[model samples]
Target chain A: MSESNLMMHHYLAKYLRQERMPHIWCEGCGNGILLNCFLQAINELNVDLNKIVVVSGIGCIGRVSGYINVDSFHTTHGRAIAFATGVKLANPELEVVVISGDGDLFAIGGNHFIHAARRNVDIKVICANNFNYGMTGGQYGPTTPLDAWTTTTPYGNIEHPFNLAHLAAAAGAVYVARWTSLHVRRLKASIIKALQKEGFSFIEMISPCPEIFDRYNKMGTAVDVMKWFRLVSQVRHGCDPAKAEITENEILVGEFVDIEKPSYGRLLREMTSRVQDKLKREES
Target chain B: MVDESRAVLTGTHFMSGDLACAEGALAAGCQFFGGYPITPATEISERMSRRLVEVGGVFVQMEDEIGSIAAVIGASYAGKKAMTATSGPGFSLMQENIGLAVMTETPLVIVNIMRGGPSTGQPTMPGQQDVMQARWGSHGDYEIIALAPSSVQEMFNLTIECFNLAETYRVPVILLADEIIGHMWERVKIPPAEEINVVSRKKPKTPTAEYQPFKPDKDLVPPMACFGEGYRFHATGLTHDEKGAPETVSAEVQTELVKRLADKIRKNAEKIVKAQRVMLEDADVAVIAYGIPSRAALSAVREARKKGIKAGLLRLVTIWPFPQELVSDVAKQVKAIVVPEMNYGQLVREVERAAKTTPVILLSKLGEEPHRPSEIIEAMRRAVK
Candidate 1:
């Protein structure tokens, strides 16, 4: 409608469903920033948008799939990876990306995540780790830090948080990386790398849930959390993921693992052909 | 395109119901199977795991029934005819995803080989106790298509029918089998693939730019466009509009979406529901049965005829949408209706409701044993008196 508005629209990614915005993310939430970084990575990769399928589970970040103008599936809670595995196996040509929150990807869907990684299925998993489950009134989840305050843990969370990058690497992900919302450029680059990787790739984003997570823990405003991320975050490329755990004192973030192996689809195809050959030989 | 020579194991073969079901699925053009091994249903997956590879199909043993059904639904959305098999306990775990499938209107098949159960009641034993659970297992007001197979032959035949119904209506179809039929070995005729009818989901004929995922056609069924086909539409379990976008706050959208999801099956009940009527012409007494119990009923009817008593059998093939009109019509001709089920009065409740004026006798047999022919004949005699 206006000259400036029209100019801004020109800069937006073509993959984004503009009509679906403004999204339902809370004001000052880092999910928007993470989404922008993801879009930027896709734009930089110059991927065919028609061949991309964005899948998400039930959570705040799961809404990301709906906002992206791709063949998307907003699936049941914690089943995005399982669903995405089917999508990938059904058609190896499509690029299946699962974007969801920490609770959905790690807690309820933990088994699927581990199994998919172990099988080395070709999928890009982007988990937004905001420490608490923001959509369900800020409940404590698997990623909630020790002593972190949440609605369910009003006193303090006694559970230890999962170092997601370490878990991904341990579970056989070919490429694993982690970054906070403050590290937009690094996050974008890592995302592009994961998207290009052959086997299972995972990227964990330590995002800010300012309205709930931050408000409960007295972690100041969203800007304060961003500043804290800048101060405490350390990026160590090619470091051992186990040594890169996030704590109250420091946040370790980097590209921890990047390797090559035969993907599940490739192996499955080979096995099928081998079996077919044996069957033909036996028949002869 | 299904290759009959490759997929169909033609001619007669003595096979278990579970194995026959797997063959039936293969003949029906099912390309994907995601399943977990549970008692009585394990043979189906084992057969599938071996046979699917030869046909260029995928068989994945998922972590549990929840993931199995989720993967099946996902594969279905990705343009594959997918299915899964489980027994009562695993079926209980799959109820959540069944609801998800209902909401998304994803076409897939689930074979529940029933056992005695409220909770793992009898894994090795046979029981048709899941009749009511099959109808009302998942939470919500949505309708489902469930078929009951009586013999090993019917198990083969009805598995194909279930897949056809699933793809025809774009709803999850259940082959509500039991351990008796699932484990029983009998002769099954593997029909030529050309002789068997298979249905695939209607794909969007319009351009991708104009395709709406949830917009129903004249039959109230929407054309599906798979992922990687460039349709670029969204699919969610939430209350969604015709464009496949979530519209949770709108009452009109929720009502229209849910009503269409249910009405599609209800309106097509005549085309979906099927039953068999044997010797109902001049009979004053009838025995209604399904699954394993129907075999006994058939025998009992013949014995009653030999004894100079007018008796018939109404075998339920399609259990859901409850064949009310058929039951009512049969009720009007018969003075009494005898229902012999493996459960304590599950389907008999529907029988009683439909046969308002007629005396409906329940001959429920629990535990592991099915109703003997003599036991059903005894019930029929009492109903007549």
Candidate 2:
């Protein structure tokens, strides 16, 4: 067996839920795929799983924590990031991972997502971008393709979907990338890199939800969803997201930027040290 | 009304419940607060912000309730006993991560000055509709300690108790003061710090390497190691193993984890519960009151005594656990019990079950106006008859 696959099996056996053997993720729902990739990466890094905190918010993607066997927090609709931020700050040494859906991350929790990214807190954020809110039936989300059919927006949507990469990149995320679930190996590799990177790393995985987004949009099962992702994904690093758009319907998929910035914790310590030093000098 | 002839010291100040809730939090050694200004609880956020700054603590008015709770949690992790207060609408916004504070076993106090609403029902008005919601608002079956103080003094004292219970159990404790208690002001004693037994969270004495965030110790709560302590540990909302990580999805880990989280509060119910009883001895009938309505009831109970009615008042200091067992005991002696609250009938339901021998009387002032003692006196008299 390939080393990555072998490692995944061991980790899955040691940590994953074989009982919920088949997760509720759509047949091709990249959520399980992305979750698998994340687990694989956690193992690859050989992170003490005990010291790894996984927090998820609401939506199909929010169930990621329930599926995994870790110190996991499945929070309310959009507060996973906030909760994750609290857990991370409360114990900065723990590797905090926030996994959620596009809607859970941006729409309800948009404020927290921006602030965390802007502060560059040490968090690895993986958002499963299915272009719709999957769990509550198909509802148009911030990432839902404009004109997509969902429960809320029966007519073709006029609202432009948020390019998540653009949002994170603009919000000062030091490490930002987008990848399709089809690129499992690459997705796993990016998760590893994101975990290892010292600042806020946002990796958007464009998974498809067939039952809701697909059925209403007249697309077929999970296979068809994966096939579509395979057909129209692109990537370019250090390029403007506006320019990196594929055909209007498709999303770009690849690591856009992986540069380092001083983390908030480091800054806090440095400031503390500087103040102490100044105090000592003055006393002397 | 001339107090200059009085020998005893007194501050007969009139304030709303919102002001008292903030003052109570300040007395609790809360060093950090993050909240957005929302009705019925706006004054709390405002007072905490000003006082926190004055005391070298922090008060960040975040973008919203979600951010407010996040910042408060962050400050706590930074080694400060942090708190946040909000009413119904803002309280709804904070539920997502409030559960996180539950799972991570993060010790912080949330003052949910509950307002009227399933969603924004009574922002300016008062509502006692959040009692059930407070007990089970978030999506988990985990236990939480909630205190409902009747007077400004209880508000001040119980806020400290909430903080102590949060630290003692290493879980989030809710100060379920209503909009009435949050705004209504009364003279409260600021006891000397040493006089109040403060229980700080267990700090890791062992090396950071040996620290397990959720290790079930003797107290059913593990010692917490904060950030910058060099202790590496994971805290999550996931169903985790003792070490606080995602564990192998085994029945054993799930059972053990859930049990410890629950047992901490359940086992220590005596230490966590608080209440006040007035003139219970030799009383044939009683009135149960909590939050601001109880203040009115206290006056009414006193008035009834003057009129030769053998009535006493039982103030619920700790609302959750319902003082259920306490009320049950009181139920046996009283002919009928009167539960007068601001809402339609929140606590009276608990009273009915507790007081099986007595006909539970409910005096509900469901509208925006506060429940006055005159109304409670009438209920107490009717129940006695």
Candidate 3:
């Protein structure tokens, strides 16, 4: 198939709410590309659509949940992971996926992110790293590089950015990966793997916010940012996440960690059954 | 399905108000508890942690109060009856998601064991300070059901009632308990599960293809569908349409959504509001109080009656929706109303509004100790004069 034919025949239309489209993302924003990638991943996995819930926090990425044609939740700011945790625990049969932005996940909601990962809750968290708070007009976030310019950091962000892959791995996520929107095929594959993972899984997608982050900096447009990513990105499988931080010149992107652990719901069910058994034995 | 064997703890036991609250939740078919440990409210979570596990339920100690309420709302969406307990500061943290719960119309029970606070003023001490906050803590215009329990037994009874009310109205119900009632221990009788009235949210009877998630019936409450129940509907905190889709720039949608959210509870105030009127039929002065202060008010009313003073007690069981009609009715007949609250006259404003012509005297107490019966009697004497 030709590239145009492939783009025209993409399976994403069926996964989106027809009326809610044309989405609210800016013309050159990378959120649309990320959403397409996510839908593609879901299509490839062939997961039961009714059993899948997409939960999002307050951000530009958070709006994705509202647009998706699935059982979704657009929760309070920075609470997607916490809410997803509840959904997973309440019904282990459902697949809870959280798609939110860096500031929503790791800044105001940093505590919940780490704790959910620590508990190894059965949920997939996809963080769109746009270097700044895109929805709130490009404020400096936890993932904003030390010298990157944001609206909140006019003199350059003095604070250090979080190495999200390292944070998730250290916080006990069973699967962790990072990919840029420029690497759509690779990012979708990683999302598929994260979705199939048993325990808590996290994927950080380094996306471009051309309207805010790129404009504040001297980066040209969304196309320019994608070109920069393609130019600087290096695929490194099983790279130590601590050494896999994205700098101005280098973007290390690949699968960093995959392991097995009992998820929170599994352990909770085990404990509940054991307690019930004991009660039955005592009654007998 | 009331699982009598697993849920009911049918016996009289000496327990604190917090423990009774946990037991009440379990008896009311609450299967999930998401909470963080805070002063006074910690006992409730601790008890829930042990008891919920035994009852084949899930108990999660969340990182913070924000996460606690968020988890409760999530559990409710996934078709589990869930609750969380907190004190003043934690309740303040949960205000954001309380609005989320209101906007999404998720049924949840929140137990706010009130402490002295503007900001963690007295963690170990008691205060009825969050009365107004319970009604208006969250941003924007919305209504809530808050019940103030004055005794350990009432804590047990009201927690169950709060859950039932939450399920019935599809709104977050608050058990506006205080530190004193939470810590106070008393004998509580637990009825069998068969006898206990447990209300669950109505589920959608329509097929997935036809169901509209936010389409309310005549009672103004939409039937809920769980996440994995083949009901592929979206829920958002933003202003949404009947299909549960976010429709942010539409003024008509916003007006209809907000009005429905407030009116559901306001319209049902007659069924939601409950109060105990003691010696009110032939009294010139009425003592209007709730929570721990109401105990003092009851004593004062009895003492004033013995002293040949025409005083009565109007103890508030359902604090929110303000019981305006009942208060107005009492105010018209009575010469004066004395409101004795632990904080500096919070609920007295409501009484003053309700009792327009009659003087509503405020007996404000702002300390660790509750109001003494003498202090309330003195206020009643002043009101009668």
Candidate 4:
């Protein structure tokens, strides 16, 4: 399909709320691309639509949940993971995923993010790291690189940004990966893997915020950002996520962590059955 | 359905108020408890940790109170009856998410074991300070049902009522138990599971294709659709339309939605509000009180009657919808209304408003102990004068 035709009449249109279309995302914003990738992954897996739930917190990407044609929840700021934790544990039969932005996941909601990953809750989390708070007019956030310019940081940000891949792996997520919007096919592949993973899975998508982040940082435009990602991105599978960092010159992107452990829901179910059995034995 | 043998603890047993509250929740078919431990309220978390496991339910010790309430709302959305227990400090942390629960019309219960506090004032003592906070702590205009349990037995009974009210109205109900009631051990009769009244949230009877998650019925509460039920509906904290879609810029949508949220409880106040009026028929003065302080008010009323003072007691079982008519009725029949509260004064302000022209004297106590019967009797004497 031609690029224009693909953009105009995507096959995944059925997965979106058509009535709510002509989405409010900015013309050059990467949220639409990231959401398209997510829906593509969901479609490829052919997972029961009724069995999947999308949860998001406040941010530009937070609106992703509302646009999706599924049982979705747009929760309070920075609480998507915590809310998804409840949903997954209550009904382990349902597949829960949280799609939110860097600020909403790591700044205001940083504690919940680390704890949910630590518990290895059976939920998938996809963080759209546009380096700044795009929804709120480009404020520098936890993922914004040191010395990066943003609306809030007119003089450039002095605070160190978080290496999200390192943080997720350190917090005990069973699967961790990173891909830019330029790597759409690869990102969708990683998402499919993350969705099927048994424990807390995290994917950090280095998205483009051309209208704000690019404008403030003198990074040209949305097309320029994609070209920059293609030139500087390195594919390294099974590398130490701690060593994988996004610097001004280069961005390391690939699957960083993949291992297995019993998820919180599975552990909880096991413990409950054990306790119930013991009680039954005592009564018998 | 509850596992009667495991969850009901059906025989009469001596237990603390917090333990009884946990049992009441289990009997009410509360399958999920997400909580953070705090003083006075910790026993509820500890007890549920054990009981929920035995009953094959989920009990999670969340990282913080904010997460605890957030998880409770999530679990409730997934078709589980869910609750969280915390004290003053933790309850303060939960206010924002409580507002989210209100906006989404999620059914869940929050058990706030009252402690003295503007911020962490007293953790190990009793105070009715959060009664006002429970009604207004969350930001924005909304109404909630809050119950004050005076005794250990009421702690059990009222927790169940909190769940019922929560499910009935699709709102977060607060069981405002104080430190004294939570810690005290007393005889609590446990009825069989079959005898206990449990109400679940109304589920959408409409087909998945036609269901609008926020479309309200005549009672002004929309039927809920759980996540995996094929409804494929959306829920948001923003001011939303009947389709559960955000309408942030629409004043018409905001007014219609917020008004319905408040009026559901206001319109149904008669069914939700509960109070115990003691010898109020021929009273010259009335003592309006709730929670642990109401015990002293009861004793004071009895002593006042013996001393030939026609004083009566109006013990507030439900605090949020503030039994305005009941207080107004008593105020008209009485010379004055005396309000004894653990904090300097919280609910007294409500009584003052309710008792329009009648003088309402405030007997404010601070720190550990509640007002003594003698102290309340003195207030009653002043009221009569």
The DockQ figures for the candidates are: 0.68, 0.16, 0.69, 0.76
- Whose lDDT is higher: candidate 1's or candidate 3's? 3
lDDT of 4 by residue, B269-347 (tens): 9999999999999999999989898998999999989999998999999998889999999999999999888888888
> RMSD to native for every prediction?
1.5, 7.2, 2.2, 1.8
Top candidate, metric DockQ: 4
For candidate 4, give the DockQ: 0.76
Count backbone clashes in candidate 2: 23
- Tell me what TM-score chain A of model 1 achieves: 0.96
- Sorted on DockQ, best first, the list reads 4, 3, 1, 2
Model 2: residue B80 alpha-carbon error in angstroms: 5.4
Model 4 global lDDT (CA atoms, 0 to 1): 0.91
Fnat value of model 4: 0.82
lDDT of 1 at A240: 97
Tens-place lDDT digits, model 3, residues A1-284 = 96655544666767887668668899878788889899999998988999999999998989999888889999999999999988888888899999999999999999999999999999999989998988878899899998889888989999989999999999999999999988899989988998888999999999988888999998998899989999999999899999998987899999999999999988988888887788879989
lDDT of each model, Cα atoms only? 0.90, 0.75, 0.91, 0.91
Deviation in angstroms for B308 in model 1? 2.2
In model 4, the Cα lDDT at residue A174 comes to 95
CA lDDT, candidate 4, residue A67 = 94
